[model samples]
Target: MSEMMTRENLTGLYVITDTTRFQRAALVESVSEAIAGGARVVQYRDKSDDVARRREEAAALAELCRRHGRSFIVNDDVALAIEVGADGVHLGRDDAPLTETRARFAAEGLDAIIGVSCYADRLRAERAAAEGADYLAFGAMFPSPTKPHAPGAPAEVLGWARERLGRPVCGIGGITATNVRDLMAHRPDMIAVISEVFAAPDIRAAAEALCHAMAADNTESIQTTEDPETS
Candidate 1:
């Protein structure tokens, strides 16, 4: 086994699974295609409270990502992530405080891969890094159907983060291959896509396009560099 949650795992195309966009039965299949297409990271985001199904799906996706050598993240639910053996968890500001979450995961003997959503706030990003978050996410940089009212981050958020922090900066929301290059100008370590990747007729092709865009910034080639865990 190789390392997981390393800074090296932060770059490239990130695929977020949207339950609304994919039927339950097809979710795993869709995610598999995404990995095959070149998604470096996979986030299992399900808003529904179907615990049984969520666990089942998350577990399946977790195994799939492991098999493909991709990092798997669970959004907003550390328990579910732990249960599924996911590589990490992504938390919104409204979710459990990072310190608490970290302590809880620590109690379970997990160093947990955690990413914090700072929305449009640079200060919050700074705080999250201080709190020991692995990466900082800012956006709805563009209007997003998934989160229509999500606050907008200024175009310079990524640039500012690069100047201010050494950790990875992930640019998300309404991100697509076509428009991703604009955000890429600031050199985001990751580009997170939902509809652009899952809603496309060909999930693999869509992911490939975004993967290509991610690599344009001299990101790691969309090839073998397994193990999200890092030292």
Candidate 2:
């Protein structure tokens, strides 16, 4: 794994690929642009049944992320993640059990970064943390076009996870540059975005804007914490 993708370094802009929006070559090109624009983590999310095509795209993306020194994650596909030598896998509620996934990685001599989607459920997040999830994700922070029907997770959940879970918390779904500050105010370690970046007219510019916004918020957070008057 690249030094860029350690458990301690799982912060900043996380971009998830939208296969429905881009084809093979376009996907690679868009991801390259996103990385250039400061996307620290890239996840390949394809729910298609075309196994061969999925493998091909994932392998290409894994290599792309490795070349760019970014974390590469396969969404809900542990086998594909292992086959493509991804840095990790992000599992959702319907995905394989975390224990089994860990065992699979251990058997393969890989220390995989596993992220669990807790949606809007704090109890689920607690359970996942207890089960040793490397990161916990909560979402639909706003109305998400990608998963429009996903459960709404209040911004407060980010704060709760950060203060109590002791794991990297990622705020995902419907995050855009304009409303990201609202989520950032709660102090999530990372923010996951999809259509806002991938479906933009200029992928790099969209990604850069999101990164810049988050950086600005982080700076303000640090300053406020350091200044006694603000406390």
| TM-scores, each model vs. reference | 0.90, 0.93
Best by TM-score: 2
What lDDT does candidate 1 reach at residue 80? 92
Ten-residue region with minimum lDDT total, candidate 1: 222-231
Distance from true location, Cα of 112 in model 2, Å? 0.2
The lDDT of each candidate is 0.83, 0.88
lDDT score of residue 143 within candidate 2 = 94
Supply every candidate's count of residue pairs whose N, Cα or C atoms clash at under 3 angstroms. Answer: 6, 0
Model 2 scores a C-alpha lDDT of 0.88
Q: Among these predicted structures, which one has the highest lDDT?
A: 2
Query: What does the lDDT come to for candidate 1?
Result: 0.83
**Alpha-carbon runs more than 4 Å astray in model 1:** 1-5, 217-231
RMSD of 2: 4.5
- What TM-score quantifies how close candidate 1 is to the native fold? 0.90
Q: In angstroms, how far off is 54's CA in candidate 1?
A: 0.3
